[model samples]
Target: MIPFPESTLLVPRTLFGRGKITALPALGREFGPRGLLVYGASFRRSVAYGRLHDAARGLVEWAEWEHPGGEPTLDQADALRAAAQTARAGWIAAIGGGSVLDLGKTAAGLFHETAPTAAFHAGQTPRHAGIPFLAAPTTAGTGAEATPNAVLTDSNTALKKSIRDDRFMARAVILDGGLLSGSPAHVIAHAGMDAFTQALEAFISVKSNATSDALALTALGLIAAALPPVFAHADAPEADALMAGSHLAGIALAQARLGVIHGLAHPLGAFYHLPHGLVCALCLPAAIALNRTAMGDKYMRLSETVGGDFATVTNTLLATLQIQNPFKGQPLLRKNEILDQTLSSGSTMANPKRITPADVEFLLSRLFV
Candidate 1:
């Protein structure tokens, strides 16, 4: 019999469906009347934005804050916290991609903290929870809504790290498939890969418990089936499946933690300014290969569930999405630099196999075309 693993599973009250975003106003009112609305810069131009505005009218007073777009920074988090304080916001609501959600979560968690956001990034413990937070993720990647960690880039060090706390968990999450209708094909591809990688990594993580393992397997199956179709045609019927899969992956990773793919992706993203999902995609095959011995049984199970071997499925997906190695033409950072960051990352510690600097160096060497 498998031994029971010690773990804690935390998730928001999730409202998932095609038009669930319309429920934001009613949900927002649960926290308070005045809310800080954080969203993507491009969302203001969408019909969904108008719908959200119409739903929120007279129900909740809100001040809109546009996400600067990209990975969130400490400065951005600080500014958002200040804005929320200035507005005297009773709650925070984010409706956009992962970056926007991370910013919103960070802002809400930091609103009452007097120290710099970097302090939290550097292991400062939060003494107080800011306010009720809600998230409506427009993208199917990152699953930021389900996580209690807000990943931000430290502007000073240019390194990506997370301020993790149970207080960062959303009070509620709105998953609307309708919001995904307008996503570009490349966005779908990149984000889908990120979700897929998260699921795979979580499944094989040493820290994975039974609950996370079950969720990760389900998520991986859905993602494997749904990502290609959605990537080829953004508004496909499979879009909702991909969205759900991504959310599940996020929850799985939140509990199970991730592996070498995320360990390497974080620093690579910091150094190269590449999209997070793209970085995961670039590192996945090599990471999988490195962990193959330790992960063989789990990988075989995943292959059966997903209807293809891990490497074959990943390569095919990469080809379908037209994702090539970003490190092909020029090296972004030295091997030692990548190795150092990889070794220091929390994800690396969760890897099923012991990862040495030599292993990371080998993985980096394979990332080049």
Candidate 2:
């Protein structure tokens, strides 16, 4: 459990608007004329790092993370920490998806510490602070760009964990929907669902308070409206809405925390090699049903958001989307299945209703054809 003191949260100042990333160079210059730029392989990404580099000129020093998958493990954090130490970066500019920005956050958190980022994960040591960072997200996925915590897997133990500290929130965040234009449709579909779930989960989370609820609802409304345009249109207003909604969702989850969707989603990424967002998507519908069962009227509000009948609206929305590799797309959502394994992971530990493993078993068993 996080020891969050009741205090006002300061969402990092965001640079949002049409063509606002152009201001990043000036911000980088203000932070430091010379800082480190941490990233994964930029060869296949939305944001053009070369252009950002050109725009920044001598103000940015570049550091690279070897892992490019959207996930970052503790081992990768160790590697990144080592590189950051050698580079002695004054400020970190994290550009890319969740993994990439997470690496940047971890690097800042682990700056003073050395080796085995797992030690920090194990609670043997905790990160007390972080160097400044600027998040430039290339995808409309994981709001790691705005959050204070970073999740990483321990390759040796196979346990995925996080480095949590509000001190890690970025100094600035840049969102440019144009960057997601060329992203693979499969990737976009999965990540977009992840964003949608974030808003929903946070809205219903027990940790939620007045501040988080407002953000969560606004995010939920935007994400629901944005997904169609973001995915269908790709390069236009829809994309912008998707990314913008994702940013809101990220901030909401940071404050309200996540429900079972994430708890169950982690295991799939660890064991099944399924995409994180795909796992989230599979787990979400059943979680909705289960939570509605537990919270009484909470799901009613969500139902109202989409339409009078939540189940019917949900079915209509899920049916309309087409994706590549239907087999792996919503893996647990096969026709024979009635629910997802994440039912165990979904509302099980949720504050209002702590679902048991037996409940998970029953719900998921119904999912099989």
**Candidate 1 residue spans exceeding 4 A from truth:** 1-5
Error of 1 at 16 (Å): 0.7
Model 2 lDDT at residue 314: 55
Model 2 residue pairs with clashes: 260-346, 336-368, 336-369, 337-367, 338-367, 339-367, 348-355
The numbered model that scores best in lDDT is 1
**Model number with the top TM-score:** 1
Per-model CA lDDT versus the true structure: 0.87, 0.69
CA lDDT, candidate 2, residue 94: 76
lDDT tens per residue, model 1, 133-231: 899888889999989999999877887898998888899998887788878887888888999999999999998877888989999999989888887
Please give the range of 10 consecutive residues that has the lowest summed lDDT in model 1. 1-10
Instruction: Give the Å shift of residue 337 in candidate 1.
Output: 2.4
Superposed model 2: Cα runs more than 4 Å off: 1-5, 42-47, 58-60, 64-66, 323-348, 366-369
lDDT of 2 by residue, 1-369 (tens): 334526645555788765666667777667765566666564235356556656766655455545556468876777777777777676777777788888888887767765467777776555456678788777778888878878777776555667777677788888887667667666777787788788888877878777777777777777777776666666767777788888988888877777877876675566556677776776666767777776567677777776557666655555454522322333453212112434433333553557666555544443322
